[model samples]
Target: MEKLYDHLITHPLIYVARDAERALGFDLPVRGYYIITSGTSAHRKLAKQFPKNIFTVEAERNLDTHELLRHPQTKKYISDLKGAGIMVFKNTAMIEKTAKENHWKLLNPPARLVNRVEEKLEQVKWLREYADYLPPHEIAPLRNIMYEKKPFILQFNHAHSGQGTMLIKDRDTLDKLASAFPDREVRKTDYIAGPVFTSNNVILGEQALMGNLSYQITGLPPFTDLPFATIGNDFSLPHRLLTSTQLSQYKKMVTNIGHKLAGYGWKGLFGLDIAVSETTGRVHLIEINARQPASAIFESKLERDNKKRNVTGITCFEAHVAALMGIYIPNASLTPLSDGAQIVQRITKKRSAVADKVTEELGKLGLNIVTYENNAHNSELLRIQSKKYLMDDHEVLNNLGEKIKNLLD
Candidate 1:
């Protein structure tokens, strides 16, 4: 990835930092070549990496300003960088506005397009019109009730990671659930009505670069035998879900959307969520995420092989470098890890005295344990807190708890 980035920097680069200092692990120094503007970051780390080839502007961290208005600090930074004719990466909504003010080129999804597509209702409408292959769903006001309807899913517009969602089976339960949270204004503010399913896609120019269907396997907690809901109510049995052929069909619709979005100057990574019905087998569009999905980190781990696929956390740094450089990457090949072999070996050594010896040896090489927790209970607490509020599936939480427990024990 560094090699690829080295090639891209020859054409000038823009670095938009959101918590840039922490993200890069250091401060940047200014000297020459390309223009770099700070968004959410306090300083430039690229300057540290390439001092002679980068210029920077520091942005303010004001939370009160309209996200589209450039804070005074950001405006000044943009002015300095633009005077030098350097491109800038604008991650924050305010900084994006600043870029437009100064005619600086930006690499991001267009805000209007993103705002439209990211809405749950709009996505469902768009998919129904364009794809015509989605499930039957009704988008009603949050306070509206569906008593005689079949089992259906509900979701909020701005929610992510499966928050603000529910599955309704009968009128009695739906009425009780609705009354439990009766502030119509609050419900409207928090969620929107829609179907639920997971979908992701990558596009470049007029082509679909990558697309795939994700299957979620869930289990019960240690004290229970019942499987918990993850994204939505789990169907009694697994269906074919979205097959590769269906993904191919959906690709055309996404390509069309991407093409239209490009008219607004969108050029980097984008993804969307999709839901399908079990009874009617209809597909329903959920919401679009204008930025990279959280799964992008894990997806970057997969690599193609000879007649098989593998998973490993290779090329993580490279992909980060590529995104920073604004390079279009089709695929990043990663090496697969051996099936628990290395982990087992390390565990065995840790059980013996050899673990201490290895730690001491590594310490001499400038490595040290930043932090460690040996108590299983404390470790479980940390794990639960990290995943709670973001996860609806108790099974996933339980599994994560077990993994942490195993590590501690």
Candidate 2:
């Protein structure tokens, strides 16, 4: 295959991320390019497969990209590649400083802008024009919270994968939280029970290109115990859940939000979390992820697989790099592509490992597996991907999901 990113070959390239497997989309065939990730089972596997291209950090536990960049081994690796161009899964002051010190070009939006826009409270104002789509909400400290013996959603200033989000079901739960964070301000909104959806979008100058919309599987048992922890995404299943009108509304919301981010001088990829009310069928904005999303990796690979059979589409990963490189792509080619689904098995009390026999059995079923080593509860332990849908229309796991769950169990 010819070089996927010919232009990027001009400069040394490095992708710094928490999990190396997530950066598979950026594994272009170019010299002087490297992928830096924490040493997990997946990263070790990738390093063995792409010895010269993959670099793993030495750490006792799983760490995010920012921490990995600051590791002694990571610093030594960067020191050897002085002027390389770098891309990070998320932006942070530590990452920017390391890049600047080494004279490497940073290919992401400003950390301050990214951080400011991701705040749950700030999202209310940023998405003000579409206030009708927002859930009935109020901003207040824990001391002033009034759940009224009902379920509600409370979000803190920052968190990832739903850690900073809470689903308060009763007065007792609210009281406990209030006692724990009596002074912290939070965005309290009426609980809208519903199915969640997420989409990845790219911003280039004044234009924003939307990517695929997928059914966000969260809080599923056997995979995660945390009520809001993300499990995976099902691309093919969402069409069964959303009507054409609802899909159009989703696209419009994403495009407008992307434009708003661009107005802040932000560029490249950003993701949006959305919820559709089960009672009223209303769609609401959940939150904004101001950096590369977890879905981008498999979604981009899906597009690549589709292209092999004559399908014409551009992946968010490709567009992200181009946008950061100042390349302009016509809007027609940026349409979202739907082709596959991916599920994650997070480390939890009930499940910890997939037996070797089970792994062999799963491979025979055509499920691609990527394993990770982490002892922290809810850290990703395994990832399963497929070109087929892993869910049924009823929001339950289909044959594939059940098979994987059963095997793991």
Candidate 3:
């Protein structure tokens, strides 16, 4: 891993990416950019400031944007970077194939393992059998859950950021869902309300090197449609979102999952979502993200602001980069910084038309627009992101979200 790190300093880590610019705040000396989907106007302007190694190919939009790195256009982009180092991190068939074809060094977990973990059902099945903290859940074809009487959280077998999640309050929504997505696979889970939190862990072969926790922003009504659509994340003044036992339990759960993932050849950063029940105060597991999360960049930036050194003595960026490169990321103790919190706000495609206006208005209020897109049916649809500093007040962030929604409304 150190060899790759040293090489990347001069050779540059090639990124065949899509909306990957969101993670570039760390400045890892990455090069060979291939943004497959031309994102929103704000993001295109921001990404243009990307270092010289970037070569965007936004015209090719056939395959899903996440799968763009595997597209032929990416292959062509690599061919154009004739004399550069090839550092493949995203686990995709085209990426691995291209790397092997060029004899480039491969980072990230095995593509197969990544694909397996990305499935919502796979992790749910594992947790249902092994973990007792998650709410009672069931996975079946849409047909089976049609007559379910009690309210539950309805989700497609594969969807995120609120695209496939809903609160199944009654049969009417179910009827609508059946009519809309007759053939789609779905998961029905016990519904509980509380503060939703996200924890990020960097995993080696069988262990978590470090972890960070943040407040997950989801389903702020009017701004987003689904009851669980992800808007962004917040890390405000330090507070105990998790009890000592709950934190330990959460870490241990993540570590065990990490070990299991290691055995499956999975590596790099993984995230878990937990819903801290307002009633019982039990930290219940929701699901996992098998890749470096979009929120990591914001967390990393906050760490820099706190100026508190990680116990491992490695910066957030280094640990993440090293883990993917198959380098050892030593264990570290993390203390949640209490100075202030920052919010990463997202305006999804449903409200994409007002996205520019939102960012522009917020920019005047000291928040900077990060990135976004425009879409009707979510073709990397309009997603505008902005952040503001609060003295660790979750309410401040929530109020801001409400105000943003109202502005759009």
Candidate No. with top lDDT: 2
Q: Stretches of candidate 2 above 4 Å error?
A: 1-4, 26-28, 58-64, 71-76, 79-82
How many clashes would you count in candidate 3?
7
Worst 10 residues of 3 by lDDT: 378-387
The most accurate candidate by TM-score is 2
lDDT (10s digit) by residue, model 3, range 96-212: 775676665666666666666666677665554455666877777776676567878887766766676778888988988888777767877788777887766776545665566
Answer with 1 or 2, whichever has the higher TM-score: 2
**For residues 248-320, what per-residue lDDT tens digits would candidate 2 score against the true structure?**
8888888788887888888888998889889888888877889989888888888777776787767788777
TM-score of 1: 0.52
Each prediction's TM-score versus the true structure: 0.52, 0.92, 0.79
Order the candidate numbers by lDDT, best to worst: 2, 3, 1
Cα lDDT computed for each candidate against the true fold: 0.40, 0.80, 0.59
Off by over 4 Å in 1: 1-12, 15-95, 101-104, 131-133, 142-144, 169-200, 211-265, 275-285, 301-401, 405-409
Superposition TM-score, candidate 2 onto the true structure: 0.92
Model 1 — which ten-residue stretch has the worst lDDT?
338-347
- Against the true structure, candidate 3 has what lDDT? 0.59
Question: Per-residue lDDT tens digits of candidate 1, residues 8-115?
Answer: 445434444332221221122322233333432223444565655443444344132233224465446545554432222224456566667767666555556665
